[model samples]
Target: MTNKDKSHLCWTIAFSVGLLFSGRAAQATLPIELEVAMEPGSSLTAPQEWTRILGKMNLSRVRLRSIRSTDQPSVTHVQVGKSTRYRVLAILSHRDELILPKKHFRMQDRRKLQTYFEQLPNETQRNASPRGRFDLTEKQFRRLFTELSQPVSFATEGKISSEVLHQLQKKLTLPVVQTPRSSVLLELSLRGELQGLSTGTALAIVLRQHGLMLQPEITRDNSMQLTLATYDSQGDAWPVGWKPEKSIRLIAPQMFEQLTLEATNITFAEVLSQLKPRLKVPIVLDHWILTQREIVPDQISVKLARRKTFLKGALNRLASQARLATEIRIDELGQPFIWVTQFGKDSPRATQ
Candidate 1:
């Protein structure tokens, strides 16, 4: 058995934020606990590879220690008997071993590692958008992903917010938080019927409609819950989908099936409606940007010249004319969907 109180580290960067050695009990809540276990046969002292790992992190808010294993005590790790758990174990393990198996921990990933020490739960938090430090460690999320991916067959369309959450919580065996603070989201009517999507994907899509998300939080005493929240620009919001396991061509061969086509002065909405039946996935618009630009799908006109091309090529030409962009996104379960948004950069893909 392993002690939960202390953190183990394979990284021994020069501690900058007055970092203490791994012996003192935590006096107050610190940043998220990180367990950077040394890979098998790796050295306890700095290695050339792990040293570069330190440079990759934005360590201003993070604390670190040099310890050999989980049993070793360190100030930067969690305390025994403390309710809170380590944000993640095997921090610098390199292999995701999760949905993103091929991924190397990136600089962007550092945001998810910290528990956002300053943004602890507060009653006042409800009045504002649900922005706080992300508490779900990568390992924790991977364990939960498979269940989130499997679809629960039902219509969450007309159900009120609270009841929908209750059913979801019962199914997943995890807390689904909708505190009084975020009451505005409760009792609000769902804009459209949700069918044929997994539990997590369905919930994420609904929340995104209102700029909210189901961010995981590990409360004290090793308890865990997924909270409904709105994140600040910097906070890592969990995503509705993962990268498709199969290549785009393999996943949707119809997208590449060639055909001669010409579209003249057709509204974007008409084009999508005509194409919707041909593809297996739904084509969704970026309503947020559309509202911002006061551009309606039916109002924008697209013109494409006669040419032999794939469905993707034809859509790209139409999307460009409508000031939109397109990409393939898969749900946690590897179900692909087509996303159409204003012509601009894509948001970071959420894979929780």
Candidate 2:
């Protein structure tokens, strides 16, 4: 007979003998003794059974080893050297021919093994589900796709944001632009097809991947408009192509009041330098127009008597004296800034 068969027979006889003596134990707490004969290539079934029984009692590996050595033959004789009972049982349950490494018996590895065991039933159920089947009909797929507005399913590999925007614009027949030149570029590949999703939903996902978001707005003519812009945690502060309205109602009256300036025979440049910080608002100089006109800011002289006036009135008076025009333009964030240009020139439009 094989060595394993012989070991199994020995273990059976030892366990039978131990059962008879177990009834006459001196104390209930004392462990039962089994006189076992072990050899190389011994049957692993006995160890697996003992592991299950001992595990139920929450015995540590060291305690289990002490019990086996004291009450039975040395486990080393069976050619399974120093393997924990739990590890032995795990290997036997999986029918793995190769022995697990010693490091695999660590607490982290044990928890992973437990997790695998727990997930097995759910995995089996998923495998048997209809959705997991590979035999989906073309008609069924078409019907599934149609149920959700026939979403434009697309997959790209390592494409930049501009290319993606172009593709989205063409597919949806809408204009898309990256407002700020510093917007993030997307460089990723999608593995699986997005099934049964809407066009808006798919677009949102793609934009979110690149740190962007889609904002919807209604125009004065009651038409829907879509814009893709950088996301702000505070709110939708920046929409790519939209401009805020410039109206007196939108500006606080206090912003234009309680401003004082008095400069005689001083350069307009010096007066403006002082007024900018006092107003605490952004001022954009039309350098392109000034360059074209060959106007020197310091050469232009200004004379203003000491008086308190509204910011707008002061700025207009200063501009008229300097032969320049001023316009108030609001940005995407609904914040206003001053734009200075030559007189009788069309104001520059905000870029999308």
TM-score against native, each model: 0.58, 0.31
lDDT tens per residue, model 1, 293-312: 67788998888889999999
| Candidate 2 error regions (>4 Å) | 1-246, 252-255, 343-352
lDDT on C-alpha atoms for all candidate structures? 0.57, 0.45
Using alpha carbons, what is the TM-score of model 1?
0.58
TM-score of 2: 0.31
Worst 10 residues of 1 by lDDT: 94-103
Encode model 2's per-residue lDDT on 241-331: one tens digit a residue.
1134545436534446766767788887777787877555555555435655676677999887889988777877887687787766543
